[model samples]
Target: MGFEELEPIFGELNVERAGEGSVPSRRFLYHVHAADPSHLRIIVTDFHSNAWEAVRSIVQLEDMRDNIGIGGSWLEFIDYVLASIKSQDAKLILEGGLDTVSGAANAKLVAQKSKGMPVISISLTELVGSAASAAITNLSLELFKAFKSIHDLYREEKELSNQLTKALAAEKERNENIQSQLEQYSKGKKLQKISSSDKADASALLNNGLENSPEKQTPRDTALTKVANRVVPVYRRARVRGVTLQDTEDIEDE
Candidate 1:
């Protein structure tokens, strides 16, 4: 029941009175202690019980620690803490009978907030010398393990989400680059359209140029013309020689 005795089970413990004061009137005290910020214990007690029955509870507080300011309202803090606790799939161990006012209220609250969480109520007085301590130690360890499982799952989900986001961004960039290249290629490969008027103008220009140019004769025609010129001169010279011979023979006859 002693705070010092439970230190081994819940890490180094710290006790502080609730509310502010220059000599506060309220006797209510709440102990907030933990192994780390992620795992925390909050106990509210009047310190009137002869036995240390603070009903120590643990919760994951690291994620929301920054959001809850030092001067934040009590309701804001309570709402965040309740939300965080309900998210956990851990057990709630009550230290009394369900018929009791506090126990019944807690059970109903659990049912409303977290539907399937298991609740166990035990009488601390029934346990002799060290039974209560042993039970609480075991339960606290189990609760811590459950909280760890949830934390690990959340971390994995965040990492996977980040990777998926990066992949999608890269894919989008790649697709954009490909589209840009395709557009450039299409522009480069485009064939300019030639209008019918332009085509007809080009054809007329070509025909006119051919008509004005000098004509070129074939090789066979040039060869035949050269052969006829040489043969005609030789034939004329032979005819003149024959006539000279005939005139000489007539003179001899006379």
Candidate 2:
């Protein structure tokens, strides 16, 4: 028993990465950060009793860099974690397993921010009390579904935006067409009014000429008939296009 306890104490416990740092190290610390914390490593000058366990507790088992077995049994791991906690006055740090790096980072960040303290690793035995796989599998499935749902909503929003662009363009064209038609109608009404007044003036002048002419005098009824004949074709065309018309009577074609 003395041999085992003194073994780690004499051999230097290598201090591997232990704090939040780069991506690779951070990943190592994620799952284990709360369980362990930190991924960087250093060679501790003293203490070999729990050196392997200390490194194992904090070192990431999962990630780009695979955790090679440091050649220690489960019992050795427990000893190392327990010793480190008692020595440092910290919680026993444990191997949190893989997929806990994010949690570790969060815990590490929070403690350092408020308390200005280093990350403390809890013991491994405290964590893996049971071996239930159901909850882990369910969580993985739910994450996949959530990602798929977000992608679908993004696609729908993009399609709706495209449809709105087309509808707005079509509406603009319709308004322009209506505006042009109104302008044309207004010009036509003004011209028609002026033309009708001119016609009345010309008829009055012709009647006065006929009343005063002493030789070969054209009759008022004959002059009016000529004017009516000329106006008939114009009236017919205007009526075809739905314009208002004035009728001339008591007139014969000359």
Candidate 3:
């Protein structure tokens, strides 16, 4: 890429320093200086091919244009840089443990600081690769696990709701049955009371007839016989309705 075209994308460049720079046993090398206010430095070291072209390939991506070209956050820029390099299949090491450093020449500082921060190191040959793949994979797995856990909880809640509904239905049915039985008991008691009253009236009528009859034994006997025929039939009907003889006698005495 022409220096005029690359300047707008990468900001200022030190051509003299980059051209003269050399890393031991490396044939191709490229270093992209991060724009102001960010401490990120992207260094590509290729032993067999052109590393500068790899940076150019990354610069052409739509993501690079949207993130780096359009003035996005440092985090977004870092992601774009990482993805771009991985697409090139360049073997490199990623270290977030990197502090605010001026140059890529200080490998010692980057290594020492790596121990202090969360770091994932991957590389092919001496050139280290990006840790993006591992980070993305872990995040995706955790999201999936969280989704499954929530789904299970919802299913359990539904089952419990169903059980509670069934229990309530059963309880309602029991209440209705109890109410029906109470009604039947009340009707039976009412019929018993009516039968007892009838038996009492019949006994009272027989007593009145005998008392009103003549004092002579023959007339009193005839009156008693007439009352007995009518009263006995009514008393028998009461008995058929479940009024016991003892119950009828108790009513007559009362």
Candidate 4:
């Protein structure tokens, strides 16, 4: 939705976006909006995940913003998130060789002004309490991992269900196809018997073949073939796919 819909979520978070100058090693809460809900409704790119780790805070965030970010007006929320890092006796201690995080021209200028030491000034863009941001970031990452795992499992189950449904349909079709072929063979046999036999015997045999003998003759009918240019087949497939319909002794008679 729009900013109005986000206001309630922001109210829950009780914080806003922290900048690059947030260097106080304490805790603070903040929120960052992602995108529209309908198109891609995922709540990724949260401030709670990337904030403290991006700036590496050792302390917690709860100790930082006092009555600052939430349930208050917009100006109060901004004031809560935006604060310069005031390091009281927190000067950088260069333990070893000169290690500057930045190699910019302005850093060189500041270093020249501060004697031969490399310039290491805090950037005004960081947030107020880094440790708090980092804690939120850790929690958010765990949630995301859990969400992804659930999503993957759901997809796998759906795929398996679809495959099972397809297999069942194919089996049903194959059974119906074999049944039709068997009926055709039985009808052909009955017609031939009628042409050669007398009235009563012919009728009885035809009725018997249609009823009691239909299922029994399926395998036998499949084994015989019509002429294909006086050869076994124009093209032949193995009987590996055939469904058995006869008793062993009866089939051996063929």
| Candidate 3 segments whose C-alpha is farther than 4 A from its true place | 1-130, 215-254
Each candidate structure's count of clashing pairs:
0, 27, 4, 18
Off by over 4 Å in 4: 1-128, 196-254
Instruction: Write the residue-wise lDDT of candidate 4 on 91-172 in tens digits.
Output: 2211212232221111100011134322222222222255546545644665566567889999999999999999999999
Candidates ranked, most accurate by lDDT first = 3, 1, 2, 4
Worst 10 residues of 1 by lDDT: 104-113
Residue 171 lDDT, candidate 4, scale 0-100: 96
Candidate topping TM-score: 3
Runs in model 2 lying further than 4 Å from the true structure:
1-143, 211-254
Error of 4 at 222 (Å): 58
Which candidate's lDDT is highest?
3
Better of 1 and 4 by lDDT: 1
Query: Could you report the Cα RMSD, in angstroms, for every candidate shown?
Result: 18.1, 24.9, 23.9, 29.9
Tens-digit lDDT string for candidate 3 (19-137): 33322433333344333322333443332321221223334434434532435653454454444433322323222222311223322101111233222222211232333333334
TM-score, per-candidate, Cα-based: 0.32, 0.33, 0.33, 0.28
Query: lDDT of each prediction vs. the true structure?
Result: 0.42, 0.39, 0.44, 0.38
Q: Could you give candidate 2's per-residue lDDT for residues 1-254 as a string of tens digits?
A: 11222221211121222442232322111111121233322111111111111133233422211232234554454344334433423321223334333222112111111233333342221112122133233334544565678789988998998999899999999999999999999999999999999999999999889777764456786788678887547777888999656555534432
Error of 3 at 194 (Å): 2.0
Across 33-73, the per-residue lDDT of candidate 1 in tens digits comes to 44242333443322232112223223322223343332455
**Order of all candidates by TM-score, from best down to worst?**
3, 2, 1, 4
